[model samples]
Target chain A: MNALWKVARFTATDIFRSKWLPVYTVFFFLIAEGLFRFSGDSGQALVSLTNITILLIPAASIIYGALYFYGAREFIELLLAQPVGRKPLFTGLFSGIAGALGGGFLIGTGLPCLLHGTADDRITILAILSIGVMLTLIFVALALLVAVRSDEKVRGVGICLGLWLAFAILYDGLIWLVLALFADYPLERAAIVMTTLNPIDLGRVGIMLRLDIAALMGYTGAVFEQFFGSRVGFTLTSGAMLAWIVAPFMLALRSFSRKDF
Target chain B: MPPHDMGRHCSSLEMMSAAAGQILRLLLLFSICFACMRTSAVHAAEVRVGNGVDFAAAVAKAAAGDRIIVPNGVHTAIDVKIDKPLEITGQAGATLDGKGKSQILIISAGNVVIRGLTFIRSGMSYVSDNAAIKATGISDLKIENCSFRDNFFGIYLAKSSNCIVRNCSFKASGRLESSSGNGIHQWYCRNSVIENNTIAGHRDGIYLEFSRNAIIRGNKSLNNIRYGLHFMFSDSCAYRDNLFQENGAGVAVMYSKFITMTGNIFRQNWGPAAYGLLLKEIADSHIERNRIEGNTTGLYADGCNRNTIHFNTFHRNGWGVKIYANSSQNNFKDNNFLSNTFAVSTNSSSLQTNVFDANYWSEYTGYDLNRDGFGDAAHHPVRLFTILIERQPTSLILLRSLFIDLLDAAERALPVLTPQTLADAHPRMKPKQ
Candidate 1:
């Protein structure tokens, strides 16, 4: 535990010294504050903030995770040469990245909402904050997994970009195509299960349900309420979200522990 | 009509000799007229009752046209019946508690007046509609300035005409739909005026079934379990300047004619089956100058015809207005549909019979090059996405997605799925209001 904290503390401070963390934090703060100031209603501002954060957090976290891991190849090799166990080193490094990104997100968006939001806006704000941090953790873990599996730098970046595009855009397009083709079938619960397969879609569904705008979806909204708004549905969604964070990080940890570097 | 008339109504006179009964009936009519004349000649008697006496005892002892004054205390009464024409007034802080077991007051005569009473806990039962006050088969009944708490029904009027229920507040906290009742429930009533009542947390705020010519004005119905106001099988009703907010299904008007709903505000009634106004099988109505905002669907028209919807503002609703194919010959003129998700969607309509002219849609992107108020290009309110969702309920998962917007744009350019003739011909460049 002591060695793990030492490695984690060292990695966090090293990243903190860079200017990109401050830039990302300031960007999030400015957007949240601007939305709060301009949107006449705070509830509306919270909704817009959730929409933007879900989109940006995954993309930014993926790119940053890939670039930082590839850029520190020599440092990782030097640390591995020391008297450190591979499991602690990998866990420590993963925690550092997850902690830095998630902490930055919560502080950036949470502070502004807590200051300007109304009493009823607290639960929604907290949910939005957690979703943002979860996306950051999930994407960073996926990027690290890609980085650990591949050796070529350019190919790793390409794979990360493709993963981001697939999850962020093409997945929804495929779902739409499936819906259009089978426009007559009863695929209600099937579509929701597909939504849980992708982390970005999970975040979008969570925020949309909170906004109470799912009713605008007509029949789909009712089905969503039935499946995702029940206690069992709530538990399943939270379990799926936790699985998204755990599965990718564990794979990346195992691969890093056994890698020849 | 007094104690004598009461005795006559309660008596079984079928065994009386025919000749003798004829002469007695003539004498009884003459005596009633003489008694009315004498009561008019003298001042109406006033009785101070119900401080320590029983409330039913007070009603039984009072004569017709007498004024009974109830003092400031709790009157625990069970099934008190008012059978004579009497004016009953309660002092400030006077209460009628039903003890969670029985109905409170039942008015059975004409020319009855009730005011300034607080009714509490008339109980809940499945067998009957337990109410704080119930008026049946009476003419010219008035209930004013009363407050009701936790009663199954606040004020129930059945087969009564020329009644006025004004300035009363009703509050019930029953959560389930079957467990609660309406605040003001009227059936088979005519020429009734219900004004300035505030109601909350009931099954429905006001329900008028088989009632006609009811003028409901300046009432606020908020946060009820079902509709704010629901009326069916009634005709010639006017609702003016009322505010309904956050009810389960907003308001429903079904199987009615000549409904003049004007200057009402409906906001934020959002649920799966909720709408700002649900109009079914209604015809020849004038709905004007209303503001509907933030509902799931602003107005839903099914089998509605010959209605004029003019000068209303529907702002930021799920669908501004949804019309079934059976709804025809309705005129939508000079209304502002602003920022709704789907402006107007139809099941499968050519819209050949209905008219959509001079309406401003916030999503309309056409320009007025001629400097006229109308746009040169026609604006079709039915988007292709609505049709897709209608075809497959699962496609609703793609709502608010970027690809759906692309699909809508592509379909707009080609005009494939959406009906071409369902459009606003003279789309206004700006809102009228």
Candidate 2:
């Protein structure tokens, strides 16, 4: 635990100095502030919040998290040689990076909710922050997995970006193709299974529906409502998320534990 | 001498009676055989055409039990309406081309089965529900292994019962929000099984309104303008093994009761109103073992009550799980809240009778030093800032601000104003099965 704490402290301090983290945070804050100011109506503002959190925030987090994991591998190797167990070191690194992300998310998005938000928007604001932090952790775990598995940073980053693109763009396209070709089969069942593999999309639904935008989106919204709109599916979905957390961490630990750092 | 003569006479009389009985039996058998032959002759009117059949003429001349099997070819603009029980098999995989004008066929009768046919280019209609095949008030009807493309509605059922639609596909390219109809739509239908179907490129992938006791499983609803699946006032139904992704919204369940949604996936359904699932006024439901991921909003429950949400995953969604205003007495247990932004959120100010226990949250920081594998203290999960952010989305900028964090810490210390009943009384350090 002590070794883990030391590594966490070290990574936290190191991350604090990285220009990318602050630049993203500053950019997020500016965009968020602009959205709040420009979206004149309450309904429009809430919609903008959903877009920022789901689209902008996760997009930014994935890029940075992937960059950080590959960029700091050499430094991580140096710490690994200092007689510390790899598990604690990995945990420390994860926690430190996650903490930095959480802090950055708070600074980028949470500050606006605190200073200028109304009572009506509080739950959504908090939901956005909670979702932002969790998403950062998930991406960080994924990025670390990519980094540890591959020898070259370029390959790791390529894999990570490819994964993001497949989930963000290509998976949906494939789903459409299947639906188009096999009109006689029950493809919706397959489509649902495919979407859960992507974490970014999962986090978006988990947060926005809580704010009650289903009235606008209609039947497609109803599909999600049937799954996550209730306390029943909500708990199940949360459990799946917990699995995501432990599974990746375990994989990373296994790879790090055996690697000749 | 007299007794021997009487015995001989009795034996002769018995022989004569046996002969007479055999003759009567033969006559009766012949008459029955003649009647059976007449019945078979009267019903032998079936016409089988390999290339194609003039459906209009066939229906006029066909008997109730006769079949008009269409052979492999493209048939055009045929609106054959069934008025009696018959088998219409498309032989060697025939295609019924609508020529982009009107419906292919309409079934208004019972005990009909249409199988192994491909329908393309249905006629567009604004005032009426046009489809490649439509069944209205038809009972004991089965449509299987059929495909519908460029139709207003692929297969539409209204006021129909005891119908089974299996292995069907509905693809619509005419995706205008004003007129693009659903892929598979049913209303006021009962005991229908819509299974193993792929529905896409329309307004709704699958829609059920006021339809009850329907089994919808093994279907993929994708890239529609609207919902993957939509249910309103639809009760006593089970939707299992379905996928809802990248539609305008994922799945919407509203004003429905006694619904069991299990083993489904909801993901990548984006937009402000997008959610893995949206529940409003849904009561007494079971949502279990479903994976909800990568949507704008996951599991938004508003005013839904007496539901059990267990064993599901909420990962990488914009917002994880939310219990909105006027929702009460719901049980959320044995679920994992992994890395979601907010594990739980509520708008109730007082007791709402919601239980959030035994949930494993990745963000949980508490310890179980005794190794009992449970958290020593209750994890005060609902942050005050969460409550504030629910009401004021713009206030999120103040997160981690000294004032906001202090306020959150204060709320954790003193539990007041937030819903008192909404808590994890026995928060688990690990996920419960």
Candidate 3:
């Protein structure tokens, strides 16, 4: 436990001093503040910020995680030679990156919403931040998973980008095609299940379940409305998001422990 | 179809009383009271009847143009059929209890006036539209300052003309749409004025079928199971300064032509298939200066044509305007679209001429370099993401995702996917006031 904490502290300080994390924090601050100013309404600003958060957080976390893990390959190997266990080292690294990104997200988005948002907007901002943190964890885990599985730097980065592309873009497009093709049939449940398969989409849903509930209630199917209306659906959707955060990290943790350094 | 704007329409209606035309209402009230006093003083004999006296017998003895005044009490007035022209006025706190039976009062005579009465519990019937007051084949009927509670239908007017319903309120208790009736149910009626009425918890607040040249003004219709103000096959009618809020299916203006709707508010009518205002097979209509807010879909046009939707404000709705491919030649101008989930989404993949021009959209991020009060960039109201959501309803879960934003940005940059005809060519830099 002490070694894990020491490693986490070390990696955290190193990433924090590198100037990228602070820039990331500032980047979100500017966005949230700018949206609030430009729209002149906290509700609408939160909506716009939600869009930016759901879209940018996953990409930034994934890319940053992949690049960081690949760049710190020699450092990781040197640490393996130390007295620390492999599990502690991997867990520590994961916790360090996740905490920094999550902290960056919560503070970056939360402060602005605190400054400009209404009481309701503050609630939505909390939901958004929670989704943002979970999204950061999931994407970072996926990135680390890929980085650990593959030895070549280019191959690992390429696979990470492809995974991002698939999760972010192609999955939605496929769902669109299927829905268009089978427009007659009831695809509400099928579509929801498909969305749950992608972590980014999952995170997006988690946020929208809070934000776009009014609009979602407008959907003709009872399934969509029930999803928004019922407590059971909310719990399940949140459970799925938690599973998303856990599943990838577990897989990455196993691979990190097994890798013969 | 539940209404889209059901979120805050009731609040908007409540807000409307304080927001607009308070002074006008006061002046109008004074003039109206003065006119009523003058008209009543010159009329014929007055017969006082209430509290266990046979109301129908009193009506039978009263001569034409006589004023049968019902005194303040809970009078058992059930199935009173009046074939003679008389003025039946209720004194303060006059109540008519129907005993949960058939129609309370049936007026088949012309030139009749029913005023200032409280009506309750006209029985439910499957085959008939049972009402508190059922008037048939009459002309010059005036109903004013009456309130109906727990009735199937408040005032049922059939084959009537030159009628006026003013300052009345209708409240129903039925929860199911199948069993409920309307507030002011008009059928085959012409040249009628329905003004300053409030209706709630009915199937429809104000329902007009085949009723022509009617004016519905300053009515507050809310929480109906079906619609607030439903105009079916009603032509040459105008409804102004009305508020519709939180209705079940929302307000529908269907199979109507040559209608004018202005200064009205359609708010909070939210449901799965809800809309603030729905135009189905409607043509040659003018909807202007109205507020449509917080609905599922603000104004849905299906098979509507040649309509002028101008100077309206659509705010915080699911979709500001949803047009079907079949709708044509409708013009939307000088409107403000603010904070809607989607400004305009259409199933019209290929463009038909439904002009969206000079509207202010909050989603538009274009510069106005020319400074003509219009953005330099042509604002396409329909986004690629909207198209996806339209085609694939389940894809709504992906709202506000990074990929959806990219697709929208790409569509704006390239103009490839979104329909070409839905663009606001002269998009306003500021909201049209």
Candidate 4:
């Protein structure tokens, strides 16, 4: 455990000091500041910021995670040459990248919202930032899984970008098609279940409910409120998000452990 | 009797005269007492109801045009059915406790008046819809200066006409939506006036169903479980100067026509399915000079047609106006759309048949080169991003991002993706002050 912590801290320091992390942080800061200063209302600014966080954070995590894994291949191999086990090395690498990205997101968006946001805006901002961080973790794990499965870096990056595009954009289109085709049926419960299949939709709906704009969604929004508005629903959705983060990383670790260098 | 006979005859005559005088005096006294009783009975116009008198019995015994005055105390559960035209007045601090078993007062007769009473704890029954005061099939009934607390339905008027409910307060202790009833609920009534009422915590503060020609004004409805005021299939009604605040879904007017809604303030009705006003399948209405603020959606219209919406202020809401695709032939003019997330969002991309003209949009950036207070260039209120979000609500997370904003700007400049006919031809350069 101590060795694992040491390795993780070393990897986290490397990623934290890298130029990309600072760039990512600055991007978030500039967007948050622009929205806070330009948008006349804090609620509108919060909504805009939530949008940016959901779209950009996952893309950034995927690209950064895959690139980092490829760049640190030599270091990983050198550590594998040491007596360090595969499990700890994989765990250390995963934690380090996820922590750096999550930390960058928090400091970048969370600080500005806290400083400029009103008392009523705090809970919504917190919810948006938390979901962003969770998305970062989930996507980073998925990227690592892609990277470990392929030996070629280009193929790995392609796969990660594709996954990001699928989750962020294409998945919604498919859901729309499903809803439109089955419009005659009572599909609210089924629609809610479908939304849970995608982490992004879950996060979006979760934050939207917090922002009190789900009313515009009509019947599906009402169903979501009944499920995601309650304490048990909140726990279940949050637990599902956590599972989204854990399951992919676990699969990646198992694959990475068995693979020959 | 010889000497005693003459004395006896004089004594007997004197005794007989005395007896006759006594009988005459007694008969006169008896006639006077009978006359006084007759006059008192004839002059009994006011009935005082207290001091161990049952309220229901008093109402039953009172004749037409009689006044029943209730003293200051808590009365027992009253299921009184009024059949005669009478006035029931309660003094200060008089309360009718329904004991959570039945309705407090049920008026079945015409020309009845009820005033100055507090009703409490009417029972909850889905079958009966127990109320504090229920007026059925009556006319010229006036209820004033009453307070209702913890009742299922506050004042229910059914199949009645030409009634007035004013200066009353209704409060319900409803923990859930299904268990609660409306504050002033009217069904199948006509030509009624509901004014100067303050209502809270009911299902809907005021609900009118199949009722026509109602003049609803000067009411403050707040914090209800459902809508503040819900009108369904009620035609030719006018609502003015009413304030609806913090209700679950604000006011909903559905399947109604010829509604004149003006000068009403709708505020702080924030929720997922909430709107400042929801017009569903409504037509031929005039909505003007209303202030809508801090709601999720200021005005949501679904299948609403031929309405004239003008001079209303839509401020600080998620969506200012969300007109569905099915709605058409509506005119939106001279309205100020200020600082909402989406100014106007519609589902269809086809040319909208409705008109959006001479409106002040805070998001408009066109220069008024001619200085006519209207912009030279037309303004497109629908953004491509709004369209995307409408189709896929999950895409809402991409709101206000730079890419989406750029896409919206490009769409605005080129008019390629957005509906071509949905532009405001005479967009105001500045908001109306």
All candidates: DockQ = 0.19, 0.03, 0.46, 0.09
lDDT of 4 by residue, B172-225 (tens): 879788898889999999999999999999999999999999999999999999
Q: Could you tell me every candidate's TM-score relative to the true structure?
A: 0.78, 0.58, 0.86, 0.73
Query: Ten consecutive residues with minimal summed lDDT in candidate 1 chain A?
Result: A210-219
lDDT for B267 in candidate 3 is 93
Which docking category, incorrect, acceptable, medium or high, applies to candidate 1? incorrect
The sequence of per-residue lDDT tens digits that candidate 1 reaches over residues B21-66 is 6667776677688865435213357777755567788888878888
Fnat for each model: 0.29, 0.01, 0.49, 0.09
- lDDT per residue, candidate 1, A106-146, as tens digits? 88898899889888677788779988998999999999999
For each candidate, give the TM-score of chain B. Answer: 0.90, 0.84, 0.89, 0.89
lDDT of 3 by residue, A1-261 (tens): 988898888777878999878988988988988898888445567778877777688888888888889888898999999888988888888888878888887888788878888776566788888888988988888888888888888998888888878887888778777777888898888887787677777767766655665577675534665763478877777788788778888898898888987
Reference A-B contact fraction recovered by candidate 1: 0.29
TM-score for predicted model 2 compared with the true structure: 0.58
* Candidate 2 per-residue C-alpha lDDT over B1-433 given as tens digits, one digit per residue, 9 for 90 to 100: 2345655667777656755666566656765778533232234456665334565566656776566677777777467677876777777767888887778788888777788878887778887788887888878889888888788888889899989999988888766766888888899999999899988898889989999999999999988888899989999999999988898877899999999999999978877677789999999999998888767678999889999998887765656777886787788877766545456677766766777877766556677878887777776556786686565343332222234445666777787766666666566675555
Query: lDDT of candidate 3?
Result: 0.85
Docking quality category of candidate 4 according to DockQ thresholds: incorrect
TM-score, prediction 3: 0.86
Model 1 pairs in collision: none
Error of 2 at A210 (Å): 20
Task: Report fnat, model 4.
Answer: 0.09
